[model samples]
Target: MKKHLLLLSAAAAALLAEEATLAPVSVVATGVEESVVEQPEAIAIKEKPEIELDQVVFQKDLFNSLPGVRIEQTGSVFGHMTAIRMPINTGPYYLFMQDGIPVQSSGFFNHNGLAYTTFGTAESVEVLKGAGTALYGSDAVAAVIDVHSTPAPSEKRTFLFKGTGGMYGYGSGLLEASGPAGEEGGYFANVHYLHSDGWRDHTQADRLEANGRYDLAIGDANALKIILNASKTEAQQADSFNDYANITDRSKAASDDPNYFKALEYVDVKRKFDYARLSLEWSNFSFENLDIVTTPYLRYNRNRYIATWQPNLPANDNELTTLGLLQRNTYQADWGRVIFGFDTEYTRSSLTYDQKFDIQTSGWSAAYYQAGTIYDYDVDYFAIAPYAHLEWNMSDKVVFSAGLRYDYNKFDYTNNLEDDSYYYALTSKGQKAIYYRPGDRTDSFNHVSPKASLSFMPDATTNLYIRYANGFRIPQASRLYSMKAGYETVTLDPETSDTYEIGLKKFFARHTFVDLAAYYMNIDDTITRYKNDNGDYYYANGGSSIHEGVEVGAGYAFNPSWRFKIAYAYGYHRYDNDPKYGDNEMAQAPNHTGNIRLFWTPWQFPGFELMAEYIYVGSWWFDDDHEAGKYKGYQLGNLKASYRYDDHLKLFAKIDNVTDNEYAVMARYAYGKTDYTPGDPALAYLGVEYRW
Candidate 1:
């Protein structure tokens, strides 16, 4: 078994070497543009052409082609749990941005926040692995993902329309238009609509998104850009089933399981989300050796969902509106440069939870709840951070960089319920479940993050770098205001991580590129909930953990017609000094993950291309206590082919799960029962495109 798994890793090829070196531009490392090789961080980039080839149906799959990154599908339509240089648990350990601006405020962090942003018109996707630099502050612990939108074209007019369909009642349409607006400006716009009556019994999904951008070339020294996006998504949430039959059949829900409690059925569980954002950016104004940029933005996001995973299936509604600004100035000289920047944001948010119906049951799966509103609160959040970055060229072959940031975060929380109110319920084990509401209060937190790196370019094709960075996540509104029995006064500190990494990059004969990195991260003051001696759960910042991993990405082009690529990562995550589960491996932190792909473009038949990919997910313990056994992960195969029939017409076909294997996208053990979220079976999609 071990040898077989090793072969799987070896067989998973990497991205094209050309893609790695061609058009190499990265902005995530610093707030400014820099080549990936010259940057001191480990970054992976997927260009627009590569994205168009994938014809991605689910946004969660957008970044899986990169090493050391995984987005687990959890049956919540566009929602996912991301793992990048950390455990696979859903925590506020990542920052998602659009065109260098944050999609959501850190005070209102959501693990499934990826759904709040649209990427239908993205020009490129960039991921900075491990801890982020000073340019990014809170919620930049594990990784930072930035999606850059396609800029308006300045030379010509373009229009495109595409339609896609597959089994399981899946269909989608995409329309895009771009052109020069006038002598000094241009505009780009796109709209996407998708629908699917999912393979599962109750997993239908629908989404609509519109994204647009306008650019104005102000004289010759400056430019003004405007960005706007909006999206709406609705989906039925599916429940994980424990029965093997349900998993293999791929047509069952929790309501169909005989062993499952009827009262716990989540057939009607669903979610609705709406998001909109508008931003204005003024950039490229240059004076003697100096450059400046300013961006101001407004964003709104609302979500209403049924908490089916929880007992009694309560309904949760939350919304937030944000006004934010980003300002930066850069001074450049012969010997590197200096950057000064500050970020400010103010947000108003509201949350409510209510149980529409009361249900009670007996036996080992016993549960009880009262039909009434439990939590209603409003929060106002304010944050400001000033940061500076310095770079020095020690020699022609080496560069050094350092940065620091200071952040001040404050939250004013108001509880609609009376102060010290309480709601009670029964747990699965027949114990009392207590929920508490605290009074209005103001809380503030402050932290400083520091980063430094040194890089040496031994030669034009070889580069080496080592760096240390610090990242943190302030307590979210719910963590601070949402209380439970025995935890009325939760004084949680910001969760912080310190990471050290070394990396090497080399190009072999200009046809192969290999990138490798190893990192160690230490997390302090991890936010968690623990049961007291009296059997009551309370939230606190009392946990610590250590994570270490090695990742490699390499690609080789045999010729212009054939290419092979491989990306693999091995990670180890464990508790450092926890009261429970000491030294145990973190739950769901897979030890191994890899991807391999082979691409062919026939020279004889121009515009015809084919690609085959193999993906592997390794085994891991299902629970933190290490008592429920391990879940041996699964592997999948996919094939894609495209034919450019002419300049204005093209066709493509994709086959997923080509082996028709039966496997689970997610599996875990809880309450002495095994639950499995089955992956989809073999499926195919066909699409066509017309461009002018």
Candidate 2:
């Protein structure tokens, strides 16, 4: 690892010596457009050109290139878990959006929520690290990611087609079209399909998605933009392998031991997801010195999957429908600016859990779960947030910003099943109730978050800033109502976090760009799963946790023909004042990670480009207990090349995991054994793109 870092540093130094110019860029994820060198936030962006150059097939492939960001693929198409300035986790810690519109309600956060968006059709993707600004509401604690759709072509009509095939029976096709309508309108539409016979057993998956956008000029100073997206995904979920030998084999579906069987049997275990959304944006309407933007959206999603990781194989079917609106008004003056906004959403959701058949095994883990309906419930969620932001330009060299937001969330939960204990069994101690159902209840919570930042610009191309922000996540309905052993009622507090960060952005000689940031976050009232002395599990509010990290990203455009880029981060995450795991390193949190890439467009060969990338992940503990020891991380190499054959045709090829190193994407200790999810092996892809 040290040698690789040294090599990357040397290459960067070499590239920095050359003279070149990289045009200035702007960031638009903060509800406003501002130059990168002037913004006080830690932001990273991937534009369409870069996405096309890499032929990105998954969201992880694009996000892993950003600093302090790590995404792990879970052996299924579009199944990913994200980590940003915190431990790798799946919950309501991060917010996912499409063109500034939340794709899913925060009350129903899902780990695979990104799949609901049409990533393949994005014109740009932006990520804001640490706690989000006051412009966003709940579930914006660790990070916020927004995907922007491709704009319609105004000059002429164009069509694009792309096809690819790779190892592991992977294949995909895409069709896109954009054109001008009349004189003041345009439209863009696209459809994508992908299929993969996953490397692991029983993990075959397929997805189909479509996106459409239209822009209409309402008048000289106002416009309307409409967006539509839909997708459907189907897969056979994979199970973790408990044995080291089976992990390496890559073919085994479960452990060889007869005592413990994998969740999925020879019979197919189906997992399906369906999503659809419609949103309209009306912007740039000015009244006096104020400009207003309004957006109204509706979305629906449904997911059906088997609980493969749980001891009891309960099949779950969940659905959510959301209607939301966003209104913003910005007032500008000579000395400063004031922005005020309000966000409101109404969601209706339902969930059902069923255990198809009783576990025949005598293992203690599955003894309490019987073959029956575990839970059936319906929930209606309502949330409203109002926020205000003030930016004061103190002087030519300094700027001060402050923001405040108030959020009100309410949930009306109704139990469809009998409000009583469903099953009971005898444990080592005594007879105990295995499952408990609670009666209908209504709960509400209110929270206030305040944020402040100061920016100092010593020169035209350099900025230094310090920012502090507060964020929170409302408890989900299931966590608030679902009951387990020894409990008839459950109450969980909302998770809250405070973050302090210092950052610097610099543009040197218009050729090199650098961004550096260090942040510390303290989270309170963390919701954690607790196990009693009787070995029954339940949800509770744990103490707290601390996460601190430093991230650096730099790009040196030596010339138009040669460019070098790198992103590196080092993070520390640990439990703080927790009874179960005091001061212990968090699970799935790596110490360091880095990505380096070199792009070359040879002058000797016309319309030809080549890219080489190196990726590294540092070691980390397998679990919070640290009983299973550490997992020595791995490194990978990838290469990509493209050639434009003509004005309308192009050919591209890529090889990933070029060294064919075997590794695990995820690992943990459970059931007195270490379980692993194997990563992808060496894969090769070739594709053709046509445009007219």
Candidate 3:
């Protein structure tokens, strides 16, 4: 690692000298007003024209410009999946932000909740590469993506409408309005709805979301901003089946008996989320050079899931709800800035499973229903966390950041039934009822996480940085609720990882750019699920593991009419103990992934644009069996065209998965099953927008 860092530093130095001493023309464009240069490497020297805010707002165009970022659809309108080819999930890789505020759920593996933001309503999406947990939180182990909404103009009220429809009963509509509400106030509101029938059988999803914000100038130096957001999503379950031959044929009937496939399962899921925030800003406080800002906010979220596989029994329901309050204050000084914040989150979750078995299934043919059967079990959980982040500019050429967080969580479980199910109590032949006593269990724990980063600029053509962070994930309620008879309660240890990273950013001429990063992480007590001899599944600590990777992205403009962009990521993971499973890498994580895109604007039509892009994902493991083989690699292509009519009206069309290729973003097999499955089907859409 030391040698690699040294080599990178030497290469950056050589590039800086050649570009600065030999090149006579100015290649770099410094447009970010607040961006401070710390070291010689911090300069962004480029030959291509500067990328303004407007150019980075659109998806097709933006993806074409970023180096290693790959944006693909997960085959559903209400949900999309992004993979960084790293350890982190896509939802956390990109920070979801409304305006400038962060929007995220406060639980592990729930990063998918960021989908609450309606993509149709976004004005711009920003993708920052590399780990960002130092600035965000534990979940940002890969990158930070920020989505910004349009801001209200000062002149007059503006109204915008957009709608899209296409094959497979796919459609979406959005309405937005913004303008000056009064002499010192402005407001913006957006509402959107999306639906898709989905390509696979029994796979459908829909979502409705809305957001509104108001800004008020309280006085000459003070301003207040308020925001409200709400969203609801529901979908039919689409678990994979293991009839390998039938599925491989692609002609199997949708109504085929699912019992033939041991892994076949289905579920119905719904989620609701809402949040509000208020902020106050005082500029020129005490002195014209000083500024102060304070913000306080509240958030709420609820999620519920039900499985329909066991139709004879009541549905299994899992619900989680949370309420939180947060306050932050920032003071700007001449040399640097100080930011202090405090937040409290209270979350509660309920898990219930109702069990029932038919007399025939239980081998009690003489009885109408199995006697002494356990009816229901419930589990409740609570958690709270507090955090703080600080940034300091030690000098004109260097900056530093540090953060700390503490979390506390508690869980409890109870059985509502007085008797054990005959199925569980009876011998292998089911000749008698099993008798057991109802009971309860509880557990709690506390954890602290810390992060640090340093940014340095050696010259106007380069930017260099290094970061370190500690992340932790608490065990889920499902892990505890499925315990077997011998254990009173499942004892879970927190999973933790320590990450280290270094990166360099550079620009050649104004139109060409490159960003590269390398990272390594050590994970302890990694949580993994396993099945016992009786077929009951539970979570267990997987000892230790190591993950390391490199990511690189570059963009270049061939000429005024055309440009090219490419990005690639390579990663490797391995367990450190137990020689057998040690060779098995993490699931769903490919060692190689990348994307390439081309953007064109014909000289004859300046208002019209065209784009084509391709994304590739390498083979990956589905489970811990190193000999189970691997899921084959796959590629996807996309095409987009757009025309602008003045500044207020624009039309666009996009065709995704142009080859109509069948692939899976993630694949899993359980209950002693095997088979690689396809993900979502091909999709296409066309839309128009009218903006004032």
Candidate 4:
């Protein structure tokens, strides 16, 4: 891998060797008469700096400006922080796009939790708060994070590279290139590799990824673009929980406990993911006072998971595979935009359980017994969804947007078992088993989700907006149909939620910006998982939840060399309908969080910059009982410095967890109590980049 990376880097440098040169020009005044008439001229024209919406931090910066956005450090690739959550068992599924084309796996559930792929190649990360079913597809209940790659520069050729390394055995490298391939075409490619030996026990991982894209300008207003992305990751599981007494007592007994560290139990996992997309876009710029665009796209993704466990019954081993395909079309005109799309998926899973038992002979000899069992199955799912979005400007200051979507899904299951009679008997007793028969059992659902938003711009410096949206998520195959006895599926209703938000934004002095938003969410059919009497886990929709929050963010620039930014958010979430769990706070969600950052450039140092940042995540509950009190809040600090050696070369360094504070962002139920797992303490890195 190292050799291949070096070769690609050399090739990129050679391609960008050609430099552009411009010639000076002089202007001459022609024989034209100019008339000057001076009067009172009392109207004072306010001198204002040009404001581009695209350059605003809310639109471009995901970590600094976006509300409800958190960047946590998981012991995954690079040892650097990932834009993920606190739950170690739940994976953060981020959306990847090349000019608005979705390039992510459709199996949102049951995917490996340690796969973090995109890095070094993204130009911007858009963190859209709340469920994203209206824009994307299913499994977007939390939020939608989109990573967009930079487009090909207008220059003939460009090359970029970066590298970093730090404590706890952390390292990363990246390479990217883009240039004109021929008269009317261009090509781009990016490759990155990262490895880390985590700050915590039994947390070590590595990852490698590559992305390639090509664009051809067919005509003045038409283009064809294609992209291929592949990523592979292998890591030791970090889901182990520390003993609750150990965290609370902070004594030697706690540290000596076997369950306090992951290394005590031998576990390993691996994952591979790949995605590809092809799109054709056309635009019409010839017509006056009107703009039109149309795009048709096809996308495919594959995900694989492998795991191995030691000292466990049957030496636990499992594998799961999922494949997906989708095609979509979108059109935008002067009045509004319309979108239509369809998707399908196939998945296969295999699990094995093994155990060993010891037997004693009567007053003679001792004997040992060993047994192993394997379960293998495959499931294929076919789904078709047609969706549309429309937006219209009602007046000069008030704009309206609305969208509707409908989905149809079908699932087929096949199993290989030595005892078919036992499988048949088990299915006859479960509600979800009706969907699985001797052959294929198919089921479908129809969903109509609506969204509306209104915006009023009273003046250039002040704006107000209100939005209401309905979102839903369909159950995955693993949740709806299981082959194991304790894994009976539930009769899950569609989970739906209605969100209402009001936002205000103000701009002053062209260098100061502020935004505030408040929202309320009501969930109808909330799906929650719990353990049954037989120690088996199942999902059910029997309650409702209410969530309300407020967010505030501001940025101020003292001058061109110094700037400061701050953001704060407070959220209250509780169960509304369940008499048993009504007033309980939701788990894994923080109640209060805030961040501050300062960026400065010294007047004497021409090409050097420095940044200091602080982030705080408030106390949170891990379960409904509130008896756990809180997981305790934490504060983290980070520092970054960069120096531009030249136009093509730059060097930078980042130091995370500057104070080496030990804290927990998540917890798990273990030994009749919630056990907290601490976050990464401290790490640092240095890197260099060359861009031309």
Tell me the tens digit of each residue's lDDT in model 3 across 1-692.
01112111224434554555422221111111132222211121212122221122113333433444444332222334455434323323344544444454434234444455544455444554443442344344444555444443334677888778776777888888877777666777888887877666555667777777776655455656666766677755444444545444553233233431222332233222333333332222333543444444444444443332222222344455445444444455666655455445444554444443333222112222242334345555555556655667787767777777676767666766553322353345455432233356676666787877788866565668887777766665555544445444347676677778887877675447776778787767766666666544445787777778887777798997898777777888767683336756866677888777787878889677787878887887766665466777778887777777778887777777788776655554444555344544456778887987
Off by over 4 Å in 2: 1-29, 252-267, 361-369, 424-432, 509-511
Q: Report the lDDT of model 4 for residue 287.
A: 44
Window of ten residues with lowest summed lDDT in model 2: 1-10
* CA lDDT, every model vs. true structure: 0.81, 0.80, 0.53, 0.51
Off by over 4 Å in 3: 1-111, 126-154, 243-294, 307-316, 333-335, 354-395, 408-442, 480-487, 508-511, 578-580, 675-677
TM-scores, all models, native as reference: 0.93, 0.93, 0.77, 0.76
lDDT tens per residue, model 2, 66-101: 899898876455678888988777778989987788
Clashes of 4: 3
Residue 630, candidate 2: C-alpha displacement in angstroms: 1.2
Tens-digit lDDT track of model 4 for 1-692: 01111112324323432210111011000001010000000000001001111111111123433455655433222222222212222432333334454444333353332133243445444444554534555644444544545444333687888777777787878888887777666778888887877655555666777777776655554455566655556555443244555434422221232322322233233334444445554443344433344455554444443221121212333344444444444455666444455555444444333332221111111122223233444555555566666557677666676767666655565654443312211212232211121223444555677777776766545557777767666665555544345443446666676767787766564346676777787777676665455433446775887778877767788998998777787888777776456667766667888888787878788778787878888877766656666576778897778888889987777776689776665564533445565555566778777887
The runs of at least 3 residues in candidate 1 whose Cα sits more than 4 Å from the true structure, single-residue gaps closed, are 1-23, 254-267, 361-365, 426-433, 508-511, 531-538
Question: Which of candidates 2 and 3 reaches a greater lDDT?
Answer: 2
lDDT of 1 by residue, 319-438 (tens): 999999999988888999999999999999999988767767433445677788889999999999999999999999998999999999999999999888887777655656468888
TM-score of 1: 0.93
TM-score of candidate 2 against the unseen true structure: 0.93
Q: Estimate candidate 4's alpha-carbon lDDT, on a 0 to 1 scale.
A: 0.51
**Better candidate number, 2 or 3, judged by TM-score:** 2
